[model samples]
Target: MNLAVTAAAAAGAPLLSGDKGTTSEAAVGETLVSRLGDAMLGLGSRLPDMRPETLGWELSHALTDFHTCQYTSLAVRLPRLLQAGHALTSSSDSPEPALLLAQSYTLATRMLIKLDEQQLGWMAADRARQLATAANDPLAVAEAARNLAVLGRKAHWHDAALSVALDAADDPALRTAGRRGAAQRGLLIQCAAYTAARNGDRDGMRDLTAEAASIADALGGTTLLRDHGGGFGPVTVQLHLISAENSVGDPAAALAAARALSPKALPSQERRSRYYTDVATALAHRGRRDECVRALLTAEQAAPEETHARPAVKSLISGLLVSGRTTSELRGLAARSGLLT
Candidate 1:
C-alpha cells in the first residue's frame, strides 16, 4: 500500500514542462509511468501481508488521493501524455507500466461515481476495463468490475451492480486464502444491502448488512491491499451501520455511531460530505432542525460543487425549506453560504 501510495504521489508529479511532443518530455513521462507500474506490482505482492484495518485505511486514503489526482490530471495532464505516448511508442506489446495507469484510471472512476460524476466515471470505467483485460489479470478484472458496480449503484442500476459483484464473487482466482475469500462475499452482500435499501426492503437490508458485517469482522486483521473490491473496512463497515440504523428509524443510534466514526478525520471532501449528510438527516429526523441545518451547511461546505446539487441533499433542504420554524433561517443561511444561486 505504501508503495502504491508512493507511486501515486510520484506519478502525479508534473511532467517536464515544454512542448508536449518533445522527445525528452515523452521519455520522461514513460519512465515515470513505468516506475508507477512497478510500484503497483510491488504493492500487489505485499497485500497478502496487510491487516484488514491497515488495508482499509490505506485503500481509503490511497483511492481518495488517486481520484483527486486523476481529476486534476485528466483535466490537465492526460491528453498531452496520451498523444505523446502514441507518437513515441509503436509496439503493440502491453507494458507493465500500462497496468498502473489502468488501475489508477479504475480507481478514479470509482471515486467519480462516489462523487456523482456520472459521465466521466463511465468513460474512465470503460478505459479501465479495456486496460485490465489487456493485462490479463483476474485481480485487475475484479477491480474494474467493482468500479463498474460503484457506477451502477450511483446510477441506480442495482441489477447491473448486483450482477457484476456476484460474478466477481464467483471468480475462483479471487478466493485465495491470502486474499481473504470472505471479503468477496462481503462485497456481494453490500451490493445486496444497497439494492435492498433502495427498494425499502427492511428485512433484506437487515439480513444482508448483518452478513456483511460478520464477514468484515471475520477478516478483521487483514489489509485492503489484497482484495481491493472486498467490502470490509472499519470506516466502510461503520458507514454501512450508520445507514442501516437510519433506515430502521433509529436516529439516536445512527447519530451516535456517525459521531463515533470521527467524520472530521476524513481527508476527502466527498467522504466528509457523506458523513455530514447522514448526520444532518438523523438530526432532522429527531426534529433538531437547527442542528440539521448546520450539519447540512457543513456538508455543503465540504463539497460545495456537488453537495448543493445532490438529490438527497436537495430533498432534505426542500423539507427544511417548508418547515415554518426553520425556513427563514435556512433561506438566510443559503444566501450567506452562496448555495442559493
Candidate 2:
C-alpha cells in the first residue's frame, strides 16, 4: 500500500475549469450522478469486473475526481471501484483490503449525500462503518462516523447526529493517533458544531467550533489527510463556521466569517466551492440579492460540477429567479444548472 504515491497522484490531477463547460456538460454530469445512484442501489444490471488488481490506483483516481469536483468522471468510475473493492475485501483476509473497501464506500456516501440521494447515502455510509470497524483502523472508523453523522443530520435526527460526532471525537484510539488523530477529531468536532447549529444551540455551536479551531491551530497551519476527504486545518474550520453561522440564522455573522478566510487557502476544489457557496447562502439570507448571485457565480467558477449538480445550489438559483429581476448571468447559471432549460 504505497499511500504516499497514491496521495501524490491524486493531488497532482488537473482541476476541471468551471468557466469553460457548456450546459450539455452539466447535463451529462447530472446524468452520471443519476446513473451512479441507480447502479449503487442495484437498479442497474451491469456489474463491473471483479478483477481487483488495480484497486489501489482506481481508488486514488476516484478520490482525485471527487476532491476536484469532477463528478462526471467520479460517477463513471465509482461503480467499478465499489464493485472491485467488494470483491477483494470478501476474498481476502488482509485488513488492508477491508480498509480500502471502507474508504471507497465512504467516497460513495459523500457523493450520494451531495446529490441528494439520501436513501443510498445511508446504505453506503453504514457499509463503510462496518468495513472500517472490521479493518480496525481508528482514522477510517472516524471518517465513516463523520459520514453517518452527516446522514443523520440530513434525516433531521439532529440529536443523533451530534451524538455520533461527539462519540467519534471522544474515541480513545482517535485521541491517541497523533497529528492524523487530531485532524480527524477536529473534523468530527466540526461536524458536532454544525449539528448543534442545526438544532438551534448557537452557544454550543460556537464552543464546539472553537474547540475544533484549537486543534487546527495546534496542527501548525498544515492541512492533513486531504485524500480521505476535505483536509482539516484552520481554513477548513473557518469554512465550517460560515455554514454554522448561516444555519443558526445569523447571516450577518456568516458573511463576517466568510470574509475572514481566503478561498485560495482551501486545500481542494471541493472546499473552495463550499466556501463560495456558503458565502452565497449568507448573502441570500441577508437579502443581498446581487451579491448572492455573484457569490454563486464565483462558486461555479471554482467548481462547476459541484455548484451545478448540487440540489441546494440549484434551489438557491431557483429562489433567485423566483423573487428578483433576473440578471443575464443569473439566467445563464440557471440554464447551466438545467433549471431554465
By lDDT, who's the top model here? 2
Model 1 earns a TM-score of 0.63
Can you write out model 1's per-residue Cα lDDT over 155-212, one digit (the tens) per residue? 7787777678777767777677344455655665666675666555668777877777
For model 1, the local distance difference test gives 0.56
Local distance difference test, each candidate: 0.56, 0.80
Write one digit per residue (lDDT tens) for candidate 2, span 1-341.
Answer: 00011100001122222333333444544555555566556564445445445787888888998889887677667776776676677788888888888888888888888877788888888988999899898888999999999999988899999999999999999878889998999999999999999989999999999999999999987656833656788888999999999989898999899899999988889989999988988888777889889989999998998887777787788788777689999999988777775
Query: TM per model?
Result: 0.63, 0.89
Model 1 misplacement above 4 A: 1-92, 115-120, 180-185, 226-231, 244-253, 256-260, 264-270, 297-319, 322-338
User: What C-alpha RMSD separates each model from the true structure?
Assistant: 11.9, 8.5
**What's the C-alpha lDDT at position 230 in model 1?**
24
